[model samples]
Target: MAKAKKKSPSSIARNKIARRNYDFIETLEAGLVLVGTEVKSLRQGQISFNDGYINFKDGEAWLVGIHIAPYDHAGHLQHDPDRSRKLLLHDHEIIKLQAKSEQKGLTVIPVSLYFSNGKIKLQIALAKGKNVHSRKEELKRRDIAKDTARQLAKY
Candidate 1:
């Protein structure tokens, strides 16, 4: 009898700016449609989340503004670095996301990208943008927590 292989998930890249700029309401994992060269680029950690966000069109979700750099050795057949890629999600999930995103100040954004069981997956979140004052308060809270932890450790 053949044994099933274990699936070891690995992280590729994260959108740190998304964490600092927004407050996440909910998060979900999603599949991505990518070509060979794009996958190679991702494996090389050649991706960026600058201005990236999820856009729904024709009842489908598309990943926009993310940049996957061309594979260094792909030559002339390389994929476009900035093309909008479709996200693979169930019909019900799409509907739910679309409805939630329609609310004012709520938006869908990609939080991170990784590989699971040899397939690439995206971690996306439904989030609301944080105001400057709220961001400042969050930073202050983090600093205070760190200080308290440090003081406790000293005793």
Candidate 2:
């Protein structure tokens, strides 16, 4: 029997506010088209997606507003810090996402950025905006869960 290879850690960046602002319905992993400096910057965990989102246009998906800081040692060859990067996805998935996103109040948002199988990948999701009341309820629920965990730790 062959031994299974262990996977190394690859998470690069995550959007902490996404969960609080939107309710995720589904998630999909897609490859990112990045330049050398962009990849290097991501490896250093210098990416931000606070304003990042997925845009579907002309039968393709593009990631916008993501900021990957220029590589510290790249000198003048550094890539742009903010650029619209293309996302690799199948035609069927792209069409499906486009149709779904066309619905009122629905959107596609980037959840996290990571490296998989030595390649850069992004985790995006189909999400719907959360109302103010729902946001408050989410906070309350999270607080209760935290309290419960703290109580359990004391036992």
Candidate of highest TM-score: 1
Tens digits of lDDT, candidate 1, 1-155:
99998877799999999999999999999999999999999999999999999999999999999999999999889899999999999999999999999999999999999999889999999999999999999999999999999999999
| TM-score (all chains, Cα) for each model | 0.94, 0.90
Model 2 Cα shift for residue 33 (angstroms):
0.7
In model 1, what is the error at residue 13, expressed in angstroms?
0.5
All predictions: root-mean-square deviation over Cα?
1.5, 2.0
Tens-digit lDDT track for model 2 on 103-153?
999999999888787898899999999999999998899999999999999
C-alpha lDDT of residue 127 in model 2? 98
**Each model's number of backbone clashes?**
0, 0
Q: After superposition, how far is residue 29 of candidate 1 from its true place, in Å?
A: 1.1
